[model samples]
Target: MHWESRHERAPAVTVLAVGAYTVDFYIFGDRLPSVGETVAATGTASAHGGKAANVAVAAARLGGRARFIGAVGGDQEGAEALATLTRDGVDVSACPRTDPPTARSFICLDSRGQQYIMTWAGAADGLTADVAAAGAALLRPGAVLVLQGEIPVAVSAAAAAAAVPGVTVVLNPSPVEPFTQPRSDPDAARLLARADLVVLNAAECRRLIGERAGSTPSGLSAEAAQLRRQIRTATVVVTVGAQGALVIREGSEMHVPAPEVKVVDTTGAGDGFVGALAAGIAAGMPLAEAVLLACRAAAVSVTRQFCIPSYPRASELSHAPLSPRQC
Candidate 1:
């Protein structure tokens, strides 16, 4: 399956990211500070780091017509985040300004590229409305609706409901709250059921399925298939850092290998993967091929520091031959 041929044959599908927005402050140090102990940082940087915003920026940079539907604070930080998205070619016309200040995150990265993050939801939680409204206004047939767990469950649920018939929904259940929380998330469960595809990591897969995942090839495939049924989605993708990403469609499973690269920072790598995956789907690449592109994009992102700043544009990604391992 040639990428150019597939992309050329199908019409371009729009990508809409509807979720959270935050300004992240990163502190780089030789090592992460232990709990109750303060450690000095070697360097600090601030950037846009919300999952939804990252996805929008990533999709746009990868050549997708991407739009963002979320709220930002009426502050300089919020202003910068919106500007960053704009410069990255993400449509922010539907993003509204809210009060109580923008969201913020503090990330501490070690020399080995390991990181620990703490976030404050801030104004991201105060929005009176707009997520569903903007999503409804922009989403239509042939469009891709992207959602994440950073936003309120109600917000995600509303946006999912607003999606026009024929629109494809992609959910990335990051943070794994829906599966980790003691209380059941009906909204999240329903959203998962409605999604055409769901992307998560290995740990998230375990949490969702309420057990340990299979480590062996056959074990992974079996667990992934079980996870798909549990989530009630037609397709599910579980990303395994370094090893690659797994794609499970209905009952079949395939593994797409990650490109070898130096790791400067792991921040936003998953977002890059999700964004690139969504963009590839919008461009008409087959699921397995799209996962391949996504893995390549993620590999490129980890080679640099920061979140959105480290993302690679479509031209920056070297095309790798698609060779997905089957389960």
Candidate 2:
């Protein structure tokens, strides 16, 4: 089937997400306990996590046809992950099952809304090239393909490349360790070149490119510029939590400041931003407008706790506050 026809049959915006699906255990309240130290958590909850799954939920919540492509273990957590994705309106028809147990993350949120997380790759690491190939037909032209660091680098790269000449691949290189150079993996530079849009946090951008001139308050324009110089992709977005986001496209740049909110947890704010951005892009919004929409979505995400559960749907986002057209 032709790519466009597939999208037409679905919805106005279709997103093919390739990455991991993890179950997250969130411990809400103050700081994490020290060794042998006991602390009472104000609340505890479990929800779906993993970069791709979060982004898939973000896209779906924002009124897009979001399809997740990854592997889950045959374990109970995997089943829960699948159920969570389905509940979020994500199409899991392309997801597979394995025997390695599903990926999972343990996240702790402090009173300040900062989070510390540890994750186990589990079945996520087993996502191979063959699996991605099986879902290649789902890459509809003009659709958005959201990728991240949760999957194998080769698999992520192949999915990104395959989207070319078909879907628009938006890569969020999270965790940032997989792309480290002189390392035991494929060349990240080559894979990045194939991405239609690259999204990362301030630290990830600095890791990919060296430190550049810019203070925390002025935003990471200098570092963002350096990354733009190093990357071949047309768009590079550097997400700075609370401070907002920066976008560099075709020699032009735009900064979208984040709206102030009572942050409860920031675990999935970045994913929400990327998902919203992809949704806007898939909906044919200009990069600048898309960045603004994404900024709004992310701002809303921080107001709630956890990852996937915190993401706002399109209707909620429509009512959220947005930054004015000034950086």
Candidate 3:
């Protein structure tokens, strides 16, 4: 999204994100060591993560007014997560603290930008549909309500159903587990039907819809088209990472290439892309242009060593030239 200075009183593009918040401990450098082997690491640091929190931080960094709604524990990690979100200019007033310990993710990054993550749900597992409904009410009309798979399915569905008329509900079904069953829960299907856009990886698209995805050269595109046919209201965006991104809407398709950059960490690349895309859409940019902007932002994100830490500010993205190489 093209961001005017906040001081100029431009209407803020509010984003209400529903998901989890976790303490992320990152060990970056080469491949993870074997069971009995210990390898040297280039660096180590910690940050606030979780699909929702990372996306909210990404949006805020890209000049959107982002708010995060979810459950956290009353422990030190929870306090730190809240502080991190507030520091990033994300509204977290509606984020509650539960009795369980806060969630945590330990990430190990390889030199090629690939990452392996292990997460603990903690209090996030307890988030309910009621909490999502309450959170949805706080979203401003025309705002964007973004959801991911980290929270309870019922909660995500409720948030999607409660979106304001002019608001866009964006769903990202990542890590691709819960919806793998042959038959989806009626409530989940209803929620998917309400999404303005559904963003996922190539594998996720396959899980949602069967192998009947078309015969296109790009399996991702074929699957995206199949998914769009199933849920008529939602546009499908399947990210193929280094292969760029594919967008399918109303039977039309577009491919946006990913910018080239040296790999470092890809932990939050998808979140970065989706967050920027949502910000662009909320700012009234056309879908194609928004996807392009999201690609650029994601390319920038992977060049750095961490997830949220790698996201650039809006001004940085606005002033930067696009990279030449296509991923």
Residue 61 lDDT in model 3?
A: 83
Candidate 2 clashes between residue pairs 3 or more apart in a chain or in different chains: none
lDDT by residue (tens digit), candidate 3, 1-327: 122212222334367789988888888777877778888998888877889988888888877778889899999888988998899889888888999999988998877877779888898876778888888865655577998888777888888887767667888977666655525577667777788888987767877776633445456676788788887655888888876799888758899998877877788889998888877776656788778888888889888867778888777776432111100
**Residue 211 of candidate 3: its Cα lDDT?**
60
| Backbone clash numbers for all candidates listed | 0, 0, 0
Residues forming the 10-long window of minimal summed lDDT in candidate 1: 318-327
What lDDT score is found at residue 208 in candidate 3? 79
- Cα deviation at 234, candidate 1, in Å, is 0.7
lDDT, model 3: 0.78
lDDT of 1 at 205: 79
Tens digit of lDDT per residue, candidate 1, span 110-217? 999999998888877764335554555556565678988887777777788877766778889877775454237777777887788889888787777777544554
What is the Cα-based lDDT of residue 83 in candidate 3?
91
Per-residue lDDT of 1-327 in model 2, one digit per residue for the tens? 121222233333377788998888888877877778888999998888899998889888877777888899999988888998998788888788999999989998889888779999999887887777557545656678888887778888777666647577788988777775623455466667778788998888877775542446364777677777677677788988887888877677788888888887889899999988877777666677778889999999998877888888777865432111110
